[model samples]
Target: MLRYLRQIEVIGVENQKKLSNSSVLVIGAGGLGSAVITYLACAGVGKIGVSDGDLVEIHNLDRQFIHAGKIGIKKSKSAEMFIKTLNPEVEIEIYDDFGKDKSLRISKYDLVVCCVDTIEDRHKINEVCFKNKKPMIHAAISGFEGELAVFDFRNSGSPCYECIYPRNIHSEKNSVVSPIAGIVGSMQALEAIKLICNFETLNHLLRMDFRYMEFIKISISKRKDCPVCSKNL
Candidate 1:
């Protein structure tokens, strides 16, 4: 209680307990994964699963603060180390491969957070979440722009990731502004906590252009023929 005194003040003991009892899976261990994992663990989520098949590199230091000073170490292991250091009471599991083969297990988790950059991986996570009726929070950042969306597959008529990007959209190989990763990733963690605590979320696609100081919430709906989500419908 002492550790979460400030958070308890905002959400109260009951909601905090709800957060502590929930489980979440975060995919990717890059810039976005760094922020998402940090906040969720600190917020007292009971069980956290981190999956990333990358190693910390010298260049990743710009935004992957959780894996700092651990270059050459596997990112999933580094994230587990950081979480254990920040909140030992929070149980964590690490999976280096978070691909379609393992996505089927996502149903066991209360929520899945997509922090990876690739649209293919996001679609994979979305398919699993939709098939298993798990809620998912998705976010991505590129340069000074980022977007976030929450899809509660447990709810009827919710939009899935494929509904927004119906085609294979590849991100340009551009360097992202370091802070934008933190901003967007933190927002992903916030949305997950809100869902666990029964708080309201945008429940729409939120696009942010930090360079222009602009934020827009675009309304989205389920695509009746979405190859990924429609099958579940």
Candidate 2:
């Protein structure tokens, strides 16, 4: 604790302890996941669970920083090895599969970070978190564009990912550059750190258009028919 006291003092021991006691589930091991997990461990989040069914591809070297030089490795194992070298204080668990509600009993974690690229899994995680009343940090990137949002389902009036991105709208292919994924992934990590450290973080949908270096944020409204968070709210 003393070694990390400089950081713990600002975040506070209580919050630090809270972070140490908390575990976060990262649903991807690609670009966004690489940056998200790297910082979470650095901040001393006690346990991090990573789930990804993909193996490292050579093309991932551009931005999937965690799996560098370890292409062809399983994502979970790759991420575990990455963290083991970064911070021994942070424990990592691996799930070598996609994180569906049926496959993952997410209640095991204090929070969930959805960094997966697919809208299908995005909806799955959204529904599961809302049902279990877990705090979720969500992010997506395509091309030079990115979007981020946070949903604390247990918090009154907090909008969910589905509130902004209804299923049909998000059905488009999510094409993204490796750096774009890293940028969004890092933002996801920042959100998680803020949540765990009791630091103030964004609660609304944030959109970034790197093509013009423009950023716009709009409050996420809860839809009355939001299947994911309406009833839970």
Task: Please list all clashing residue pairs in model 1, or write none if there are none.
Answer: none
Model 2 CA lDDT for position 57: 95
- Off-target runs (Cα >4 Å) in candidate 1 are 169-171
What TM-score, over all chains together, does every model reach?
A: 0.96, 0.92
Residue 162 error for model 2, in Å?
A: 1.5
Residue ranges of candidate 2 with Cα displaced over 4 Å: 2-6, 99-104
| Local distance difference test, each candidate | 0.89, 0.84
Instruction: Report how far residue 77 has shifted in candidate 1, in Å.
Output: 0.4
> In model 1, what lDDT does residue 231 have?
72
Score candidate 1 by lDDT.
0.89
Query: Which tens-of-lDDT digit does each residue in 10-56 have in candidate 1?
Result: 99999999988999999898999999999999999999999998999
The alpha-carbon deviation from the true structure for residue 107 of candidate 2, after best TM-score superposition, in angstroms, is 0.2
Clashing pairs in 2: none
